[model samples]
Target: MEPDAARDIAVTDRAFFHILQLAGFTGGTENLMKLGEMNWPDIRDLDKERLVAVYPIASFEQHGLHLPLLTDTIQLDAMVESMDGKIGDRIVCLPTQWLGYSFHHMRFGGSLTARSQTHIRMLVETVDGLIGAGFDKVLVINGHGGNSADLRVALQELKETHAETRVYGASWWGVAAPALDAIREAGPNGSGHAGETETSMMLTLRPDLVQTDRLHPDGGWPPSVYAGRVEHFRRIDEHSSRGNFGDPTVATADKGQRMLDATVNSLVEIVDDILGERL
Candidate 1:
């Protein structure tokens, strides 16, 4: 409540950083100044109408035995980093929302899920908040498949409720399919969740996180046919005993780089178009 307390906090921060430097801690101070990061005070001065808010939504879920449980969230970090590098001047990149609806993967250990209704409400409020701040476009770049159905609903509801602001949602793989398809080491049947494609990407982005000893082939749990034309949901343990679908032994760092580059390029094109809209 007083100037002395504020000064004390600032002094403590400086002392802590000085101690870290002396101990050879490697975190870059420049990262503390990153413009779009929510922790930075500079965000308060940002003019929403002049830039777009790109939110990356991911999940904390199991990614087989080899990949980390946070694959979706980590991959999104890489994706957002790529985009932020090229267009920092025109975007208000929000921190990622890592919790997602992953009820299907719940049986597998380490996976966390939000109730479907709560997930929908979270997305709606996030976009609505951005619109209220005067941003012309609110874009959600989703990396988890489980969130797809609800995300579609959330985006649609946002449009109906706030017609004045343009809202868009996209699945990264869908947007960059042509490029990823050309370089992938597996076919559709061999590539899905924690498949070769994702493994390769992680190998390039964070190889240490990959447990090479666990490389194996798995296509996941299969759905059941209902009424001779429909299908019923199945649990991961039932479909994929190993908690993974698709072949992963074929992953390579090269494919990861190519995949990441293609997605970044695709996103750049999409974001440019969104920013150019006549809102």
Candidate 2:
């Protein structure tokens, strides 16, 4: 390659990495972008045995007054960071998807969104591409609640022809719910949106971005207990006015650390399951 062209490529790579860091990919950069910080040739030399690709899907949306719009992306990236510590060398962490379906948050400034179909299409195609690239296992680690249903749909519809190739989707929060109950200070309704739970995690992961002065209660319009059993959809404006639905006043960095550890522990078990399938 020519010197100028090579320099241009190098500059582009650095710029992209910087963008990822600003967008909440710094903590997870190492694991989420190939392995060992090696270039293409290093990857080419790796063994071709069973491969697992883990990708993060997050939303760049409103998170009340206290949290940044990229809270979901930041949290998801942190999950990749946690997972990398536990299983980095064994799996390939694909880059994270920074945009998600956050139409409800569009009313709030700083929220970015995509059509549900677009989100689904992007997820399915990404997994399909990974499988086509010879990865035997594909795991999508989701960060945005709004993307949950669509991610489930995409995971269900993946074109799987080989028993060896497995595709799975999981929201880190959901996966850690059982463990959260043991440590969470917020009640069910209090942790709904930009509530205490999420705030706590953000406090631990990116304290510099959190604004304590803006903290407030986000008790969203409570739904009937019966409605919880079924699929019911509502927008943010109709439910909560401040773009949050839970109490963030009680969030603490210590709680955030514990919750993060719980999430990582849950992922460890899940990764084992994804890679331990018998042929």
Candidate 3:
């Protein structure tokens, strides 16, 4: 409430850092291994070949009427943040790439996307840069379902170009499928896009962004003649008029916490696999 109090806090912070410096502790050990927060030397001094470089990518697009446009990014960021807390010193995390391949959701406002090839190229170049930086192990984590195919293409291209580099990618849900299946209350039709799974995660991570009053079930299209035997592409509007898919009414913060835990635990295991050269 007063200038003296503010000065005291600042002085205490300065003294703490001063003590750290006197004890031969550089600032790096105290913080997470986030690439964006570190200086050039800090990155250059790392054991590049041994440390995993995590590049998280998500979409900035519509998440139905109830969820925020940044829902996918927010969910993915939460997973990454949790993972960082577990194994941050062993990996360097790049800032999450917010834009993704969301052309299917273009009909809805606030959705942004890049052409498939462009998105692939962007991903390729980013990983290539990490490889150039001497990081032998790289992991790309995808958040939005729309970006899944493009990510595979990008990873394939990267492998073809840099056969020796250890570059891998996985969607958060795909990696923890069994766990999600065990925890989800919704059926197959209710866990697709902007569905119970995502809603539950949002409720756990950012309840304020979720419009509880507007939550409803949508996009449970009846199975067509080629439902499971073949795959087809359709815009979100084609299946869901409200710009969402699946049921959100079944979502709860407790389910969300379980999902979050499972996802993060799987991610940590994946990082371990990378470190062990198992994948």
Candidate 4:
């Protein structure tokens, strides 16, 4: 073989190998981004200063008559997986924690929840474990609305306990709000629980789990002067008999796909910011 030809081939091979590594295929066999899939030694050897630890938290809860009980978790799993595909080796992603604070939806029978305190402890412990293992930066991605308050509490507890560590939490919708707002046709009532956004995302991620025939609009807050100004605890069954809020009948697979893609893009941006210390 000619020397120039061999040199060119070597350069091409090296570039391909770098691309593979960045895409999480380290040994041409495994995904290094997924912490659960990697062995301890691999994790221990990782560059802790640069790699961001990710925890995806969601819930097994009711999503009205149309969506499945695992709606939140499933959508979150897909979002994390997509984010992994984009930001591969930069993040050490944990498996999605499918149990969240869903006590409000317990009336529907399929919802499961950990008490708020217990859930907060669980989050703190999980993130603490990552910090113990040398990861100083952590990001918590939440999927279920009911888990939002608990996540905030958990974040506060984690920061107070691990003063030097950097921790962040955000719902997928919250992170991708700009993109969602661009496409949202529903008024305020169109996108709450089991609503257009969640249903569309579920349709895009797991169409089989969404019951199309059962699609319907369901939700309304109590009529009070303090309705929008107040934050109160209310059971799903209290106002919504169908265990949902928002309009599901208008959800479409195309909208779901767009929302998922936009969310993934937003997640990648945030992960990049975290790694760059810009957030």
**TM per prediction:** 0.82, 0.84, 0.87, 0.87
Q: If the candidates were sorted by their TM-score against the true structure, best first, what order would they fall in?
A: 3, 4, 2, 1
Per-residue error for 245 in candidate 4, Å, reads 0.4
lDDT of 3 at 108: 95
What's the CA RMSD for each of the models? Answer: 8.9, 6.9, 11.4, 12.8
lDDT of 3 at 257: 95
Candidate 2 residue-wise lDDT at 176? 91
Clashes of 3: 0
Top model by lDDT, which number?
3
| Each model's lDDT | 0.74, 0.74, 0.80, 0.77
lDDT of 3 by residue, 101-147 (tens): 89999999989887786677667767766776678899999998899
Which residue pairs collide, candidate 3? Answer: none
Candidate 1 lDDT (Cα, 0 to 1): 0.74
Task: At residue 35, give the lDDT of candidate 2.
Answer: 38
Model 1 spans with C-alpha error above 4 angstroms = 1-44, 220-231
After superposition, the stretches of candidate 4 with alpha carbons farther than 4 Å from their true spots are 1-32
What is candidate 3's local distance difference test score? 0.80
- The true-structure Cα RMSD of candidate 3 reads 11.4
lDDT of 1 by residue, 1-279 (tens): 122332232223223322222212111112222323343234546676667778778888999999998898888878877787888777666666788879999988889887777677667765655565456687789999899989999988887988878888889999999999999867865668888889999999999999999988885433544423666655677778787889889999999899999998988888888878842
